[model samples]
Target: MASSFSASWLRGDPRALEFLSDRFRHRAARAEAVAAAASRPLAPALHEVLVARNARLAPSPARERNLELLARPGTTAVVTGQQVGLFLGPLFTVYKAASAIAAARALAEETGRPCVPVFWLQTEDHDLPEIDHCFVPRNAGGPLRVALELPDAATSRAPVAHRHLGPSITGALAALRAELSGNPHADEHLALLERAYRPEATLVEAFADVLSSLFADEGLVFLDPRDPRLAPLAAPIHRRAIEEAAAICSKLAERGQALAQAGFSEQVHIRPGAPLNFFSPGGPEGARYRLDPTSTPGTWSLVGHPEGASVTTAELLSWLEREPLRFTTSALLRPILQDTWLPTAAYVGGPGEIAYFAQLAPLYAHAGLPMPLVVPRARFRVIDDRARRLLDKLGLSPDDANAPRDELLARLAARDAGEAFETPEAVEARLVSAFASELARLGERMAAIDPTFAQAISRTDKTVRRGVSRLAARYGRSITQRDQTTLERVERLRAYLAPDGAPQERIHALPYYASRLGSHAFLRLVREACEPFSGNLKDLKP
Candidate 1:
């Protein structure tokens, strides 16, 4: 049996719940608007670009078929994407892809339209540290965060797509293998990871290769925006962003403010006068920089690089026309660009993505593009036999695993103590009540004797309460010490349920589960467990 819970969003954001519930009255209007916007026929050149990119990737038969489907005249896609992370990042990456695949299938069935699932690889992001590490459970005990350190050449402000795993990746792989050796499928799991994270492979290629291997049979098409072939297709969107730099900034700022006013903080901060495009000039020495509106009316200045230069709108437009691959969309504008290039029917996203879309709605409206239906991806926490047995032994649910460590430990210790130990709360409450009654009587007697005696009584009352609190603390310590086995059990459970005090899916990488439960079994569990747009955290018993 499996247990589940609703996803807890940042600052208790209700937008995801509302979106999932169809509570927003304007949802129909938004859908209609998106439908109209997507009704335009896709360009022939765009199809050629996708075909060319697909050919370069050497996609699986299923993926190649899906790419072919995407080239059809009226075909729209269901899209979801994430930054390329180590070993495919956390489990949510797989969940996100699964959700997109399921959503695409469902949408095609309902609309009688060709819809393909596309996982856009966000390889243009330059934050290397964010994707450098992944957590895996140590064979000894607890979880270990393993990272492949980058050399100076690969550590520049260049996008991750251009970065390669150097010699150091072998050590990272060795460490990962050591951790997984306890599992029966360790050899197979390590082989897959090694094949993907080869020393000579770039991060983007590695991510695409591993993801392609995992979801190839499911026909999930992987798109790398940095592909030179798609540069011309994305040029128009980049041109619009550069030309209307000020207007786009203004619209984004206005929308961000609206989102904040609606009690949701903006996910992507819109800096005043900042263009929603990252510019990377051609050449090996070129570094990525953010574009900002210049003092001149229609010019934009490159910021974040010491040698950054200003470009007139005409110059920027010319550069985009010539080399669109040099420009990348910012987080806020990526969705709009995606919709502009691909006929996106729906976008499957996580909680944060869903909240951020609220801010992008205005951007979509401003761009004359329809905001696709933002569907929250299904979230899952895999529980193997070990975790399940521990949970059952503790007689706890998955939600109980989220309790604070100390609180959970105390609860378990108390239960193990049976009727022998009284909880600190009960003891403190009883003591306070008894002390209150006695203090009241003492206060009456002291007042009768003399006013000074009242002060003494108050001091004595404070002393007694402090003594009681100290005693309670001592008792709790004693109980905790006496039940060492219970404490250990709690610790073990914590590691399994909330390692590093976070959900397993957020902390452990996919290889951890794939090793414990064979890769095929793990993938099958995820596919069977995931319920697209279900809007609930799935508890999977594998």
Candidate 2:
């Protein structure tokens, strides 16, 4: 097996993530400018929840302790996500939350702004299957795979499944603590985490409960949109969002038709006319949907019915007009809210999150929101002692990590030996030529010994070729080892970008987030490539 991979392996996709990372490295100044004006109340409701949750099991309660120090007026809210696990994925799931908290603290120190980071638990996300897995470092002794422990009579309806949250999470955390031998207070940490995520709470609230431990001492307020008081502030946004979503849905129908005509089996849906997301009144009871009847099938609700009463486009628009504030908070209202929140100085996001944010810029402007400045989350490329030692042994540079492993190995080997061997193809060709020459010489000698000499010579030639083939393969494998080491490292890093795998690499995932970091990154290098395309917003065809 080959060892190394290069940025080239991502093909010529300008939107490839690897390329975007390279480009974004130069845009640090722009990001700083955007982070300048953002502000929030120090002791936001969200931060308090985080502290309380963390305090439950924590021996010292650092998260809660930190919240007490910084809980005050004039703080900036830092937000991020976690996949219901401690192990962050290739996309830096844990780091996203950590960075937000860290950056908030750092920013608070610098700007004199009390910064508190909030971890938004995506409980409404229906991809139950995706959140079930967690990665453990090799030294941690392999990855842990866990599944939801749904009850026998558990219906898709809220109450049955709602009860599953606390146990499943507690059980999973316990299992993880048990697996890690000799880790100090593993049980305590897990217990503290359990206090953070409560079954009766909203996904956002549950998220606050667990993540609060990380920043509770900062006096962070854990605001749950599920909180009835906050509901009023967000409700208008929610209702309008749903109404706006109806229009977006109409646009999507037209776009889908065009995609179908273009011979696409699966459409790249942007919800062009639809809003990005909406807040619901209660968990499951106030469920939000992208469209009443999704173009894609199998969209039955928990009770086996469509989400809302099917209404004509005109009727939906009228409903939005009647309760503009309420519908504004629906998926229909997303584009408008984004527009309302516009001139957004900076939006902290992971690479994929950035890409989806980019997609909304045009829609935001169309909906009258200012185009916000985009910033990648604090990034990390982990290099442990083993990784460092391996790099040193190979005498490879950080830049070399971006090169094709096989090529880098060949180069390294040639440098070490002061000479290089022929390519595998060339070596194979030489072997074939040598076998032919030997067979010719043997054929004449064989004819002198017997009449069946030609057959004998043919057999001899086959034997010689087989021997060369075997020898060549053995040599190839040995050479591949050098490249394999590098390849493994690159793949490991790639894993963080997408734990499940890259969006395009997957069967049905969206390139929305991946494209955000990658495409935006590549834009710097290949601005000229796309400059020919006008700024005109081309209407998606019906």
Candidate 3:
């Protein structure tokens, strides 16, 4: 396999292009050229927004407890969380959350924030079906890929005890290892993974334990959204939401005919109102919520029990008016539950999360909540040390890595050609001489047709100039490709940097946390983002 290049060299010649087939230029040269082009300062608006938003928001009471734990002398926390499918599959995912915890403590120490990390279980997300399983790379020992697996009804909601998780998780690890044919250390890696998979603990617990030692001083706190205390906090909101949802269903049913004609889905855009389901810190349910899928399907079902035989939009509105308390409770309680415990100042998330938070900005405003500033998550493309060495040889950068394979190779050939050609002035002078001679000949031919054909002769002269220029350009492709690797690289980079085109698919799978940076790196980055950013839900990337 060909080796890759490192960032240092790639930055050197941002616009260098090469043809690998030519063998004169290694791929690294192109990479270095591209990286040089891509690296630039972040937009001013983004930076200002981040600093501004980080200044506001705090955590709920439960989170406050965790925060206080970190505040204690020499204590820390490892933290991470996911939208929903976080717990579905893959051992690397566990690492990502744990890594976030490790990163938080590291940053905390550097900044003297005494930060501890914690994982927030997104149990309430109604999109439970999405987080079923994980896929790893097809190659056994190399990269990672994801495949989806559905959770059984019981394990789906209730916090999965460690006993229920360990064996099955181990099976997954073994399968992953078996798939990786040439993994030299597959056995050892599997052993490490097996130890990390804690079946007796819930998903949050298992993740925390996996990273336990990383934050030995600034320890990890695990929070399951299903915890009894938290559930009830969401109860009033949940109840009111369910009731209002029924009404929404009723309205949808009534409008079904019209909506179908308009080609719209049954999705509703919820806005907080009258029956504020806000709960206080001391709610009886202690802010606990069960991970039941019914909350969602119930809202959509066409027929059901007491809430109504069938729901209408008006009924949904009535339920909202009836149970304002429940809805507000969840929002008010989140800060107390998580942020109050950590000294969080920012939230980092992917694009979707960022957009979702943006959508909820008005709700936060209405509830007297401070919206957190959102920052895009750290993205990485892993290339091993060998690739780095190869990059060094070719003097390339990551940005140059994606150009057409043929073009890259062609660059190498051009570099080897190394022969300097005549300058533009010389070529222009030759063209001028040739054009003058051709025009004179054309004039003679026109004169032979008629002495008064001067206009036709003039037009023929202009046409000859245009045609010669076109022919010259046609003959110059190979010459240009040979002479200017930098220009070639620039052209290739432009293809990718186009505003409308996405050169590669972004990885959003839960396991991305682990596979990209390993568990420790993943956890720390996420926790740092979530703790501070959660307060400003508007800041979370969609």
Best by TM-score: 1
lDDT of 2 at 318: 47
Task: Give one digit per residue, the lDDT tens place, for model 1 in 452-529.
Answer: 887887888899999998887776676767766666766677787788788787777888888888887888888887
Give per-residue CA lDDT, model 3, range 466-494, as digits (tens): 77666555434445555455444434332
Question: How close is every model to the real structure, measured as TM-score?
Answer: 0.85, 0.54, 0.45
User: Sorted by TM-score, highest first, which candidate order results?
Assistant: 1, 2, 3
Error of 1 at 277 (Å): 1.2
Clash pairs detected, candidate 1: none
| CA lDDT scores, all candidates in order | 0.76, 0.41, 0.39
Clashes of each: 0, 68, 128
Candidate 1 lDDT score relative to the true structure: 0.76
lDDT (Cα) of model 2: 0.41
Candidates 2 and 3 compared by TM-score, better number: 2
How much is 472 displaced in model 1, in angstroms? 6.7
